[model samples]
Target: DKNEKIYVSYDSTNKNCKAGDIEMAEYGHPKNDVGAPIINYSIAYDMTNEKPLLYESYPGSIVDVSQLKYMLEKIRGYGYKKIGFILDRGYFSKANIQFMDSCDYDFVMMVKGRASFVHGLIMEHMGEFESKRACSIKAYRTYGMTVKAKLYADDETDRYFHIYYKAKKQASERARLEADLDRMEAEMDKIKG
Candidate 1:
């Protein structure tokens, strides 16, 4: 098992909790409901074993982007070498990326599609691999292509951007957008009346 690549998925969620002796249970941005004390719970999950490797609790006021360095240090302290990370969009930030790069850890992070750099990449590479059978990932039922570039202007390392397209997901998202637009239009008409 030591020779195998270790991949961990890191994510966090807020849970409503009573603020008694627990100092971390403070009111912050609640993911579920507003105006309640919450505690942030994060987990590092072993992707290969399909189980959690570790969990940590932190103040709800702390954002995900700020916790990456601390979590990475803790993980490394556990004697895990040759580790890779699968991170969510909330953890995507210049500082976090740089910290990970400094530690020399491999990671795949979800980038916001609306980010200018990401949008530009999508526009530049649009339609290049979507219809190609060779680009299809059968297991995920999606088409994917990779782009290599520096994340920062002065970075010594080249980062790879894996762009994927799923037709079913796109159709579902479009339907949701249309429904939302219809509802907004009706609300505006009622307000005008």
Candidate 2:
């Protein structure tokens, strides 16, 4: 069985450009202090084949989430059918969710941060699997991909969510918080001195 599942991931990246190199790009924040013109573009990547399916350029002045609608339509023009999208949490929104559903696309998007329901879910079930050894999983550069998932629905919207309990991810997140607190304390010490 050589048949492979078709999965596409949509992501946008910012690039440096000349002042008038692109028509739509403007002086937008590029997450850097570089005083140069920038351009933003979205690429639909075929994760199964490790190739890019479609790409759409955009004005650099726009944020990533703001370009989702345009990117969706641009890829649709490429005439790919029955393709599923795996998107990052940054693309989560009521409008985006509705748009994907309207387009009849199978989509699996990562949920970000605390929606009230997600928080409640965590509170309700996190204690059930609190040990690192219980859900220890190796993923990417960390042992943190182990997850327990549950289907969730938003009361205010029709969007359904899958909440995951990732122990290694949680550990990594706690390390990040510890780092931030360390930095803040160091700053306070410097100021006091």
Candidate 3:
């Protein structure tokens, strides 16, 4: 099972509990409108088997970004070598990327579109694969192209970025942005009047 893929995600939800001796019950970011104490928990899921491999609960004050290293270590302790992780944008950070590199773990993470590194890459490779039929993924209805580059200027390792684009999504986002701009302009005009 060394070659099996594992997708890890960390999330927490609030639990409404009275003032009691529950050690992990503390106030943190509430995922819902529960006006009570909360506890943060995370699960490491095995993607290949579609089941949870491990779970851990911690104090509510702990954030998900800070738990990546701990979770990676726990997974390693379970004797899983050659691990692959699929993470969300919240886990995308320079330190996390470097740590994963050090551990020799493979990861596919979502990066914020507005990040300067991502923006630069998009601009550099714009239109290269947008219309290329060879890059089209019919099932996902998106065009994907992989580029190998350093995640940071000082990094010694090169990472593979699977950049994807969908024309319909782009058009929809553009329209929404235009509508927001028009609304803001109208509000400004009213203020001036």
Candidate 4:
């Protein structure tokens, strides 16, 4: 009913609960990074007003990805005529994307660097990218971090992928990958010893 642009962010928070005190509380990876009997409460917020739209609690063991279906349905029930969703990387998946597309919802989610298909696409188009500031927002960020974006239509899935590149992020990702490999090798040696 409102004319203002609608945006929502999906996220979760985990909290420790006492035994028999909170229903659906069980062991899962704690967002606090502490091993405890915690329950995760997944919440969606209307970004414009920052109001809570819907929330669902799951066992501590349930991963965030598995809860997207439940949360998506809750948002759809809100009956928003025109709205766009902004979700974090953890919520990105082919199945989730397909589901959202099937429901005819507009969403923006970042595909992870580890996704092989996205990686291949990036490699295929990396050379075609030329440095440019398309608009004011891009111009402002260009001094520190330059961005290049391209839109590609996927005929197989009937989906379109808008891939963005940041020079800083690309360099950092390479360094991070090398560090991870070194750390893994060290851990493996310790395990063998």
Candidate 5:
């Protein structure tokens, strides 16, 4: 929980991990997507109130949550207790949710519209987003730190999106204007005039 004052961090990658040594005969053969080579990385943080700790590294997908569960369980063996797994949208999945629930752990994760339908439901309530000064307490109670943030709605989809925005902070306003100018120039270039 943000109110709990805990540690936070992230994991990412710039290159793909080698799937495996290719067989001499399989050099150009069709390959499994997992065997097609995807980037692999992970992040771990110590979410013990006030103090922050973060660690990240490349650990092939095979050692992912399986290793994570092993490590967390071992930590419990050494006597550590915790709550909620916070993760990026890539790590969100029905299986992950079920695993966490079964293990008595709560979590916070961003949902990607490409991966799940939950994002659509969230979009439905975006117009009623709570302001920075105003929050829907009852919604929080029901959704567990989840709230529909008021963001731009898509005209075709009518989907609401929550986004972080500076309230007219000058630096950001200048940046937005610069981006707009760039966009206009690009549009002008595309025209047949």
Candidate 6:
């Protein structure tokens, strides 16, 4: 199904221009301050819903967990509880994850490589599945469970918990592709010359 949608990005700086402010040039005019004095807003609209839900916003360069929690609470007050929170890689910190866990919220967060250090306990358990030819890992926590899924590249059905093996193979394939491309480019240059 196709639906028509329009989105607006709201900011805190929308001020009306007065003749005196324009003439005096001391207070910034409306043109100078594009959207001043308004609250920041992000909204996602579903045609089925009677009203749009305000999903996200960032007032400044950095947003702390407290600011996010306040924004979410305000949104939840409007009767939107089934919320999915998303953040850029810059906001991928241990403190933020802990906050999410404490608040009993589910989030789809960008997992930066460095953030994996927080899951060192999981990494340490990798060796337990080394001998198994095919396996998957399931982790239990007081809150919920995590499943580390793996599948074979050659055969989709043949999945295993060989983390190191998969990572090394992927890297090797990438290196091989780069080498092949370099060789092919050299050949192309020779033919052109």
Q: Tell me the tens digit of each residue's lDDT in model 5 across 83-162.
A: 55666665544555555556555566666544335555545555444343353345333211244432233222222334
Clashing pairs in 3: none
Write the residue-wise lDDT of candidate 3 on 58-173 in tens digits: 88777677778889898898888777788878677788988999988888888887899998898899989998999999999999899999989999988888888999999999
What CA root-mean-square deviation does each model show from the true structure? 2.9, 4.9, 2.8, 5.6, 10.4, 14.1
Model 4 — TM-score against the truth?
Answer: 0.67
Regions more than 4 Å wrong, model 3: 1-21, 32-37, 188-193
Candidate 4 — which residues are off by over 4 angstroms?
Answer: 2-5, 16-20, 130-157, 170-193
Clashing pairs in 4: 28-60, 28-61
Q: Candidate 4: RMSD over Cα atoms?
A: 5.6
What is the alpha-carbon lDDT of model 1 when measured against the actual structure?
0.88
Local lDDT at 80 for model 1: 80
User: Per-residue lDDT tens digits of candidate 4, residues 1-193?
Assistant: 5445678888887898766767677888776756568988877888888788777888888888788987877666766656678888878766777777777678877767557767776676665443544422364343222233332355244445655656776679899999999999999999994
Give candidate 2 misplaced runs (Cα > 4 Å).
Answer: 1-5, 18-21, 33-36, 132-193
- The TM-score leader among the candidates is 1
Error of 5 at 99 (Å): 0.7
Alpha carbon lDDT of each predicted model: 0.88, 0.70, 0.82, 0.70, 0.46, 0.43
Candidate 1 weakest ten by summed lDDT: 18-27
Candidate 6 — what's its lDDT? 0.43
Instruction: Write one digit per residue (lDDT tens) for candidate 6, span 1-193.
Output: 1223322121222233333323222332233454432233345443344445455544332234335556546645655544445554434555555555554455554444334442553476655544344443323111222344421223323212222224445568899999999999999999994
Best by lDDT: 1
Tell me which residue pairs clash in candidate 2: none
Compared with the true structure, model 1 gives a TM-score of: 0.83
Q: What is the lDDT of residue 95 in candidate 4?
A: 74
- TM-score preference between candidates 3 and 5, better one: 3
Clashes of 2: 0
The TM-scores, one per candidate, come to 0.83, 0.68, 0.82, 0.67, 0.44, 0.37
